[model samples]
Target: MHLSIPPGNMKGTMEGEASPELKLEGDIPARYVMPQQDRPSAAAGVAPIPVVDLGRLSRPDADGGAVEEEAKLRWALETWGFFMITNHGIEASLMDAMMNASKEFFGQPTEEKQKYNNIIDGKRFRLEGYRSELLQSEGQTLDWSCRLSLQVEPEGERSFHLWPKYPKSLRDVLLQYASRTKIIKDCIMRALANLLELDEDYFINRTTTRARALARLGYYPPCPRPDLVLGFKPHYDGGALSILFIEENVGGLQVLRNGKWYNVLAKPCTLLINIAECIEIMSNGIFKSPPHRVLTNAEKERTSVAIFYGVDVETVVEPAPGLLDEKRLARFKKIKAEDYYGTVFEHFRQGKRLIDTLII
Candidate 1:
């Protein structure tokens, strides 16, 4: 499928001259600004998201350790739809290099960065390049961030032209990170499948080589009035799962739970893993796709990298047969990944979410 933006509607132009640095002098355009009630709160104390250790789960133990780990995984998925993974096997140095490379790339002059503008070859959903806003409508709220998004898996399909050339070490480091994370994703998918009493490779096998694995590097510039703008809007991911790496010093990510918004604390060398809409459907509503948003900070800039994994576009997604019983019938109808994504893109343009459209 193809998605494009007209030349005249490019980002940062209407508000003023397009530049790398954020324009902090004028009032935020009405469309870019959100209502006061929608602004994030400065609550002093908030509960922290759960953190799970993969290394511990992998080590052999006689105390029914594996069972305990699986239980924890199920609880976190059912309760938070998100969790932070520690000792996930990715090297700390490599993670640092990836973060530094992202910062270096976005730190380049606006002219140089624009060379990799998201609308690759003018109009195609190639899934690799840079973009300030994914949904660019006439009055849609724009995110206060710049993003570099690219597909990193099934290596053969990579578009080297869309990859950045500067920061010499970027391509190498990102490839290394993606390779390692793919392993983690596979391991987690196996555990999730077993948790539902399905074959260990149920998820891994369905995610064909053509499945899209995208990495998004986000840079949120400090805002003059943080309360007036959003770094990102409230939305659920359209993919199967996402692993996020955030700058330890800057905080802005928040997830909605029990009708309250709670801040997601940035922990050093830890990856935050969250379930997405596809997983929710595959799990037959046993797992949730939570709504999350990023708030802007007045003094601190925030940067994050998210790796989104999904099945092939034409693959049919639905509640697994093993997960259904007399009392627990399928809660979601079967649908192709492409159809689901199309619905998501449509709802996104209207400032809505596709989660509500998946109910059986």
Candidate 2:
């Protein structure tokens, strides 16, 4: 089914030509404001998250480097469900180009951005487009960011018409970045399968050729009262995995670990990788899908691009055969990717979460 936004709705209050409501003239609007307890704080004195070096893993085990790297990867997935990786093989120049292209697109005038609004041709749900907020109910809280989401892989699925034309370089750069990141993702997946004692190609072979890949670019404008709004709500990812690239100087991403929030410091040319709910299920809960959120900065604007990797929507997601045992029975029922995603979106609209529903 296709859904389109009305022409009158083109005036976005979030990232485009800011409507009066989008501006903070008085006290922050109660709807946009977050509860005090949900606010973010500094993670001073907290232990930093582990950083995995892919280059080391690529080396032969004669020096024991590969052994140590594999252990780190296992611990990161089993414990934090996320990690940072350097020497990931993506060219530094390409990373910079991708980031620059994103900034240029968001910096455009509201009218130009509105042209690619999530609803295309005024009648279809072109998921690959722009959106200021994902409001599902009256007076729902709005995120303090503008986003451009597009499918980058499984090229046939992309709607090139919706891709931003103003940046010109955005498409080419993103396509290249996606190709490189896929290599990194495949390496990680192979390592994961080996870690589980399954054939190295288990995951690579199981994942359909038409697996869906989406790149979601987020632009957070400086907020007058950052404490009152959230850049993104706290939740776990619904896909199998996500690789995130954040602005170097503007830091606001936080992950909830052991009941405390820890700020994720931005590292130069490193991508943050995290397992998603589907991976958690596939591993029978051995790997976690940690909950995380984005905070808004009072003075600094921030931008992040997240590439979500997942199986085809119709593929059935279930615990891997090799991981299932009498002692470790399946904890989740087999669910189709499309159904899981649908549930997630429905719950998100109601300010709910899909985590609980995944457990048997």
Candidate 3:
């Protein structure tokens, strides 16, 4: 696998107004096809991503076990940048309910799901509801999936009208699930700060004021020619971190490591955690943000619920001074969080890493 960054296409070049689900036949569309040289490969027998027991490090009566677990967490961040965590304190039942809510919403009739369409006036794209990624260029290869996105943080700024109403239980279940994830997010942030020997509130403080989070529910339908299309393109996330609830027994997510792609097998009851771009900058390159993507399934449909967490959009994101010293200098330039948010979709569409531009 390789990472490339090219200037992306602009709006008004898409082939259609509605998502491709309306056009699904057994055959893949020409626009959805990738170059033959860039098709996906099977993982075969490679090892899956790491799994960590996060609860050990957060135990109130933490002992030597905490010290050991902390080291594991640090290594995972510095090397893998992705891991599945168990015992982080969120309830299993709530997780199940959240997954069900996403399925319920996407399973609705087209007219019903259209009530909260992310495209307003059939032109502008809003991040608050059901939609597919915009094709900034006519030749852009499309993903084989649709999604529902909702702002789950900065509660005051959320657009409630875009929130779904058909499921009836969706709104309430999503709220509870978001609240619980916030607690886990804070805990991990504090853990990172403590590991770096900085103030425990270093990360949490930035997020408390203007931080933003979005819950993206992805629905990847079965494809006839799975090799011809991708469920998601290859790119690392552009936020601080992301927590994911992927459907077990269905395989799709894959992470790139050592120039080879490895399938991320799902565990029955673990929540996957991915360290993103901003966190790598904050760690002064001590932590890595791995590039990952999803594969289209030939027989089974895949669904996942993920919440992406980021610092305040207006704040300038840079490495912590404490992480720098006379021996080590900054490796990246300071960039406004809002800038990444603004250009992220275009970057993803073009198979580029926005953070690569910030590398010093």
Candidate with the greatest lDDT versus the true structure: 3
Superposed model 3: Cα runs more than 4 Å off = 1-26, 44-47, 60-63
Q: For candidate 1, what is the TM-score?
A: 0.89
Using all chains and alpha carbons, the TM-scores for the candidates as numbered come to: 0.89, 0.90, 0.90
lDDT tens readout by residue for model 2, 192-240? 8878898888777645457888999888877667666788878888778
RMSD of 2: 3.8
For model 3, name the residue pairs that clash.
none
Candidate 2 lDDT: 0.77
Point out the higher-scoring one by lDDT: 1 or 3: 3
Tens digits of per-residue lDDT for model 1, 1-360 = 222221111233332244343333464545557766787777724446777778766664787766677677788899889888888999899999999999898777766777888765545444578776544554455677778888897789888888999889989998999989988898788878877888988888767567889999988876666777888888888878899999877878888888888888878889999998888989998888888999877677777889999887877898998988898888878888888776777786676767666677
Off by over 4 Å in 1: 1-27, 120-126, 134-136
Clash totals in order: 0, 1, 0
lDDT of 3 by residue, 1-360 (tens): 111111111111122244443343346556667777667976434445667777777774535777877888888888888888888777889989988988887676556766776777656777788776665665567677778899988989877778888689888998899898888899888888988888899888877737889999888877677777788878898789899999888988888888878888889889889989888888888888999888887778778999999888876788988888888899999888888788876776678888888899
List the candidate 2 regions with Cα displacement exceeding 4 Å: 1-27, 42-47, 120-125
